[model samples]
Target: MFKVCGYTCNRNDFLKKHMRLHSGERHYKCEVCGYACNQKCDFKRHMRTHSGERRYMCKICGKEFTGSDQLMKHLRIHTEERPYTCKVCGKSFYQSAHLKQHIKMHSGERPYMCEVCGKAFKRSGILKTHMRIHTGERPYECDVCGKAFKRSGILKTHMRIHTGERQYKCDVCGKTFISSCYLKTHMRIHTGDIPYKCDVCGKAFISSGDLKAHIRIHTGERPYKCDVCGKAFTQNSTLKAHTRIHTRESPFTCEVCGCACKQRGTLKKLMRLHTRERLYKCEVCGYALNQSGDLIDDMKTHSEEGLFMCGVYGKTFKQSGNLKKHMRTHTRERPYMCGVCGKAFPKSCNLKTHMRIHTGERPYKCEVCGFACNQSGSLKKHMVLHKGERPFKCEVCGYACYQSDELTDHMRSHAKEKLCEVCGKEFKLKGNLKTHMRIHTGEKPYKCDVCGYKCNQNGTMKIHMRLHTGERPYKCEVCGEAFKQSGNLTEHTKTHTEERPYMCEVCGHAFRQSCNLKTHMRIHTGERPYNCEVCSKAFAESQTLKAHMRIHTGDGPNKSEVRGYACKQSSDIQGRNRTNVTFAMKHSNMIPGSNT
Candidate 1:
């Protein structure tokens, strides 16, 4: 046995070679490259590079190397045999040199230091790569795209783009990635491994890039900026998305509806409309949203205090934007206007939705019935029909509705009615009184593009357009019957329940709808509001007046059917020729209870 400097060897030649390190002597030297080594084998291996001789070859991959040890290390990659491992972390390495470098990480020793940035690395190659940042040197270049990278590994990964290759695959999800680093980062999603942590906040992130971005939030540092708007962002991706607004460039487009969006995140949110994917959910209300930002906004509804209050109505709102929008109602201000139709809206989102009418764009769709709509709220409300989920319920009437706004409107019915001073009419809502006043003013603001039909309310115009489009959005859950208007559906649904809420006071007669009871009251009161233009004959019911019109129009019922029908009153027709008189009543196209 031979030993020197606490190192021992069995062979005398190995001991003599080990002694050269203490003596500071290198016997074997390369004259061509000026490389020197104490070991004869290492010196011969270095000399092989000059001669272009790679004697050692891998059996599996046919890769050539100058030495046998180099070939052995290369073979481990194919075999996935990591012989060398660190004691501290138990991390295995293919080569002993890698294990040595990994041990330096455990020791907190970064020997290879960059002089320019004073940054340290465990390995010399990593330090060399770091130095390129200061020098702006990208040594490795791609042959296809001519893109340069600081490291050969990055250049190799970049080449995969041109090659259309995704070599690394996730074992769990089978998702492919270009590089092993990307695969490693993706594995964290399955593993739930948040290794990168912020020292200040103790918040952990899946990747180092996320951790770096999160750290900028604490520092209030926005490195990325838009040239057009001068708006700053924490992320470069956000800045690129912001730049598209100035360019009016919508790069991401929906494959299903062809709706173009400026940002990828916006496109993703739009895709959720087609997919019906609601990932982020509100814990308080169980309301789910596609995007995290929307979920965050919804969460505020539960916990947020009424910080902003309206001066005119004394209404309190959680957000300042809500307060601003509420003020528009009181002022009757429609600030947002459509470019195509010159239609004005109180909110910008309302204007955006109105533009879809001209564009004929309906992005939101129901998965069950193939019902499509321009608005997300419409799709959400439409989904309730299939699910039969009435989340919002009125306490007073026990009326269940899909939307909170519907429940709010129903609750107002129990409250004191808003009075119209001009006509002495009572309304459940203040908006109802305003709409009723339009009848007196003869102002019809909302007009249908399909037809020349006009109405005072926008909602009424929308329902009227359904006559042309044949869009029956409101459906009866009991009978599977559809109606163009929601009020018609509500009235139809009462037939299934056989629940008569409205009643006639005089005869104790019950009616399914309140409008039916109102028409019944006119019979006992002896009021004949509907009058004929030809003979000046008046009738209590609109149907009776409509039947009376057949006398002049020559489209009257058969003479034999109405022979005994000397109808003195509207109820008198019920006893005489009920079938023939009902036929004349149904045929009338004129407005009900109006002078025809």
Candidate 2:
């Protein structure tokens, strides 16, 4: 019914040739070479290579191409047109194939599969490189080092070393890198961009790999297992290093120290320790540390303000991990069990050292003291005590201490020095101030069970409990003297040491303990909190008030400091006089506060 025109007939022939190009059915042949093409358009483009013809030209950039399709794609860049859009995520792309790849992000689809390993990838190019694992084919080779790579892109990056090319540059730090991806990661420091976040802990990371590792902490999933020892690791690299332990491999050797390590990273870390290099530092305390993890742990100490409470004794510790371990003492739960003896401990290191005790093995030895210990940490602590090292210091009083416990005890002096502005009464301790305030409120919270004896302080009830139980837990290690309370033991320890750690601010006089220091501070403040309820007499100390109460109770005479003093007998006096007579005669020419 219709007649075909000459132009329509020629267009039908051109469409038939384009369909053959898509099918890859090459039929046309070249005369000079053995090159074959499916369509006349490809053969015409190939002839332009010998003729040096550049027909297609870009109007925006004035760039020329031999093909029309290449010119059309290049023009789209200047037009800024993206016709392709992903239906799954509503993401638009300039190309249809790019939109298809974007849909895979939502679908989690990995269509490309490798026949050799049964592994899959979202992209075909990734699967192609993965195939090299079975074939051992490295097609791309570097001219400089002659190192072959499965992917041509890796070889191209390797060639940068021989060419001395640094293409990626950071605008903030002015740092140059060979790869753009590495430069983009380094830029996160200046930008503070943490795109990756953990779903469980709400912790953000700069990189996705860090987020992946952090997620394992919440999931407790360790997929990487060592085949030789059947040990599991959360990270694959850690498992690889653990495998080397079974193989007894020492591949990484330090050039300077001549020390060999199983892992390369361990060798690098040891080199930094030997060099005394502190790359990471704490901003709060100016504490320099060799590793970033050490800096993080140190920051936790400052944030907790050195207040760590033990769950078992209702006592506080300076370290959190110490309190965590001490909690096991109350629950009697030991998670780290010995494999051979079936004995368990709160900490893994404790269990390890305990095993050595049964084996009669002392691995850690003191170089100077010649003392052997089961653990290196125990040896280090012993050495510190031997050296008389006082590293910890109190910030309030500028007092240096040998241990954290001593610093905590020193800070109690500051708490005792707090005075009431209205009453001008100083408290011996914060707890004492709180209890004395309850007296103004008529609040007697602590009631005894035996005689309904009521007191304002819980500490008074604890002291009263000794009457019922007849228990005295405090004992002196120096003189074998027993006490009903810890305060008495602390006071007795001073008699053996003759060491006074607490000192007065106004006067140069020192005291044996913080309680004595608190009593001395009342002289400067002119405040007395303790009162005699019977006669309305006020005293600086509760002991002085107790002595005043004796006057009201008609109990006995209040003894002074020198009331118990007695002169020695004639035989002892004569012996002391004979020794004094001999020493006085010898040191008569010596001046006071001077060597004779």
Candidate 3:
């Protein structure tokens, strides 16, 4: 027997080989691959990596491994087997070295100590790396450039930029990487295998490292911190990118416009302006978008889920940006400023339309009539004349409308009601009920700052502002006429076309305006809405109230007074207006208090 250090071997050659382990000698060499080992067993294990030989197999999962040690380690995952237990702490581990590391914590035994920071570590390699941090010593330097790295592995990875040596390649995607671990992680994307899952969110990740990173989001933990600014980030890469702002380093440059950016992502985004590349596409609509965010926005048309909601109207929106734009409709926020003219708009699209007047740019054109317009909305409206398209149809009432807004307004009549507590009136919509309650409550919330004019509705206040401002915004291109209200302009346009949509059921007479038709209905119904407070007499029209009130004011004659001086006063009545003449004739006495 041959014995060296508390170990005996059967043969002298075996003892010599065991001595090589302590001596760090690699005598055994493989001719096929450039692999050398201190012992024959290690050389045989290394050979299996090149030979595609996997002899050991897991009994539970039938997973093959090149070595028995590799298979034995993998079985712990299925069996939950931990054989090695720490005698001091009773902390169990699958490997004996892990148990040895755990026992060191209780013993307070640190073999490796940093000279610079006075920090102690269990391993010599970790202590050596810690010393380099205080010294700022990057020993591994690049061959092409003077760029240095702290570790040899980091230097090897950096050299891939110069050499373009992708040692590991993905079998599925053909994606290349410098390391085997990165290739293993890339394989999960093809396999759709997520081993680690978040307990809170149930979001699965490829690796335990990524799972740990995601858990920080739930824990509100930001371990990676910026030393320069003291700002914390979820990711180390984000902190690295943020450091460039403080340094004023724009490393990434746009090749097309020579524009410099702090990050490569910003440069790629800038390049899209020249490339016009729309990579993302909507699955439902086939609408191509330049960015993934825009694709998410466009996909909202298909989804019923609206994450963002309006506080005022209770209207839901898919994206926060759409919700922000919708809130502007309530707040009347006009942030978009016109540079050419000092004008602001509630929306950017509205500002864009206003710019066309200054630029004389009419991009939108009617396909049927070839009528060019500044806005696409105008072009769409113009198309209705040619096609008579009424796409917006009321579900309850068989009525169709050209505009979606008209249909939305028409749908209000069909909606379920909410009762007003003050008036006991049922309003189809909650907003209308709120307004109706305000009328009874005498709450005139919409008040004019200029004239102190108060109104119950916001629309009335808007219309009243035009009186003070003298702003005629809506203009007719046909007759060169303009109006303060858009509704007035819409009615005026109908007169030119001679289109009378509203009709009287009694006389078969048609009117261009719906309000005119409603007034005409009052004649047949004889509904006396206006009542005099003094006389207690009701009239069909409000104009009739003025004529009736003239009796008490000595402006007109009573029936008894008129008949006393009939012929002489009647001639005086003929000189008066038609209203006074009708009053005079209605009275049998057209004499007294009827003097000219």
lDDT values for all models:
0.83, 0.77, 0.80
The list of candidate 1 runs beyond 4 A from truth reads 1-57, 62-72, 79-92, 141-147, 191-203, 249-429, 432-596
Q: How should the candidates be ordered by TM-score, best one leading?
A: 1, 2, 3
Q: Can you write out model 1's per-residue Cα lDDT over 341-430, one digit (the tens) per residue?
A: 688999998888898888988978887899999999889888998998999988777889988888888898899999888889999989
- Checking candidate 1 for backbone clashes, the offending pairs are none
**TM-scores of the models, in the given order?**
0.44, 0.41, 0.35
Tell me, by lDDT, which candidate is best: 1
Steric clash count of candidate 3: 5
Q: Mind giving the per-residue lDDT tens digits that candidate 3 earns over 1-596?
A: 43446778688888888888778889989988677888877888888988989999888999998888988888988889999988876778988777877778898899888886789998778788888888999998998998998998988888987798998987654668887888898676546477998899776788888898889889999978888989998877788898987897889898896777888768877887789976565767889876655766676667765357789988878777778988887898899999996889888888988999889889677666789999878878778878878888887778998888788877888776677776678877778888878777899999888989999999989889999889888999999898999999999999899989998888999998988887788889988888988888998777678676766565645233433432223444554445555676656455655554
lDDT of 3: 0.80
Q: Is candidate 2 or 3 superior in lDDT?
A: 3
Clashes counted in candidate 2 amount to: 1
Candidate 3 lDDT at 450 equals: 92
Model 3 ranges off by over 4 Å: 1-169, 172-416, 421-424, 543-596
| Number of colliding residue pairs in each model | 0, 1, 5
Give RMSD (Å) of candidate 2 vs. truth: 20.3
